[model samples]
Target: MQKAQRLLDLAALLLRAAEPVSWREIQEQFPEDYGGSEEAAIRKFERDKAELLELGIPVRWLQGDEDLPAGYLIDKDDFYLPDLKLPPEDLALLYLSGSAALAGGDFPYARDLAHALEKLSFAARGPGASEAAGQAARTLSAGDGPGRGEVPSMLEELSRAIAAQKRVHLVYAGAERSETTERDVDPYGLYQAGGAWFLCGHCHLRGAVRTFHLARIRSLEVNRAQPRSRDFQVPPDFSVADLATREAWEYAVHPPERARVRLDGPVSAEDRASFGPRAELREEPGGATVELTVTNGEALLRHVLALGDRAELLAPVRLRRRAGTILSELARRVR
Candidate 1:
């Protein structure tokens, strides 16, 4: 079976075609990277057409010639799917989720998403239908979410700074630390995982876009004199999933060999959920051992903090030393 491509690619192909295209014409646009024969291509095309049609792209069967018949082509003007908009069918789901977010008072963005849903739902729904949607939404969010809050607003602030090429100064207080340290930043971008916000920025102190925790930001202000450069671009070497994991250590930069860690039973599921995609895990006596290469010391530290007592870094003498430092500080703070 063949999987259809993203509609954006198909739209670009269709727009470039000179005339009404047959199935073969569409097939030619398939990149060599996508392995499929003409017949296989047609199957994928049909699926793609269906998906596009669902999203309101005007792909249809053209009236046939009296001569030997040809297949369909997308309408020239309507070949592309409109901007990303949830269909009427999806609006119901969005309302339910948004309603829950509103009830919890955690996600402020939910109010905006809900308003957008209301506009769509009004057009699609019948009378009294919206009332039912509200009730269903309430039921879905009955359980409380213990996940960290304030992440969304922090991401918003970082995003603004990145767009405006602005510098921001903030006081960061670490999990175990008593005092706050002020850092001036060249804001690069924001990223998220597991309900946490990370500000990727050139920390004036560190002289790099070292990831900073939104939770640790005790105070914030923008610097007016030292604006960001228009040419600044984030490197492609890092990512959200890599920088946020639940093991004793997790990071993306490929090291000489992936550092290995052994985790006890209690935090095994938590560890697996965050780092399992990158981890090569092996079952050990008490729990599981996970292996991964890392470059971001901050991400690794965060992972260690997540496990608290359940994780043990197996190899790399430097990591053990860092772990000792963290534990020593934690010990002092607790007792």
Candidate 2:
């Protein structure tokens, strides 16, 4: 059976079951989808359950009634949504937002967003919900440009490895490196920012925690030599976002030093928020100055450059000079 059909069947079976259905029953009902050894069936079920959860279907494994063994079922009360009473405009906005994000194609979880939107559309029984959703989707479709290329398959493989806590071996092509090299990595987490995906993990080769751009990974393979259960573990308090911000130089970096940048004029709340918590904002009648610490000078430089004439590097006269030289080179090229 096709995977999509199997998923629908599994959901239907779970939703209709009055008591927890045993694993055996599930296997029997979808023999073509889950047939094989018990272990294979279990793995299949696990993947199906994950897909169901991603679709907003609450598939739960719990203790069964007297004769039934513990298995899976959907709690209809919780699985279904109450009437939202959302006006047509609001529903249209939700549809448009989802459609835009779907078109943007940079979100790490973009693949699941469509499924989520479908569930939301079904739940929205408020007046004019159907018409609102249809209009929103139509408006978005009409405005969208050519669709983005599909995300690399490696991203999906890495996601599974992260979920399974499996160690991976990668041939990485770092920007500064002369040649690609192999390393074993225990992925702590994944992040998406600035339209790129990054994997944060402990690298066996570097003997340090590092963030790797997904595009820079030339190849990836699971390290089967290491027992899955015995693989490296991520610290409970470890934060992917904090690591990303620091590594990306969006926040304080190693051997941090203060950076002061002058905003062109009338700095907005967004301008202040861009520097993260480590920044201090000084407001003036004309504009504003922001002081923040950074570890990666190059990343900071790139960020300031991207802001165009709206911002300028003030402190660290050396960086300011470097920025000036870059701007001059750019001007010459454009001419």
lDDT accuracy of residue 99 in candidate 2: 65
Which candidate comes out best when scored by TM-score?
2
State model 2's lDDT: 0.75
Q: Which ten residues in a row have the lowest lDDT in candidate 2?
A: 143-152
> lDDT per residue, candidate 2, 233-329, as tens digits?
7888889978765535654445777789988677768766777777788887688888877777767777788888889998778788999999999
- Residues 256-315 of candidate 1 have per-residue lDDT tens digits of 455667788755465776665766787878788777776555466567666767787766
TM-score result, candidate 1: 0.44
Where is model 1 more than 4 Å wrong at Cα?
A: 1-115, 119-156, 174-177, 223-241, 245-248, 251-271, 282-335
Alpha carbon lDDT at 180, candidate 1: 85
- In model 2, the number of clashes is 0
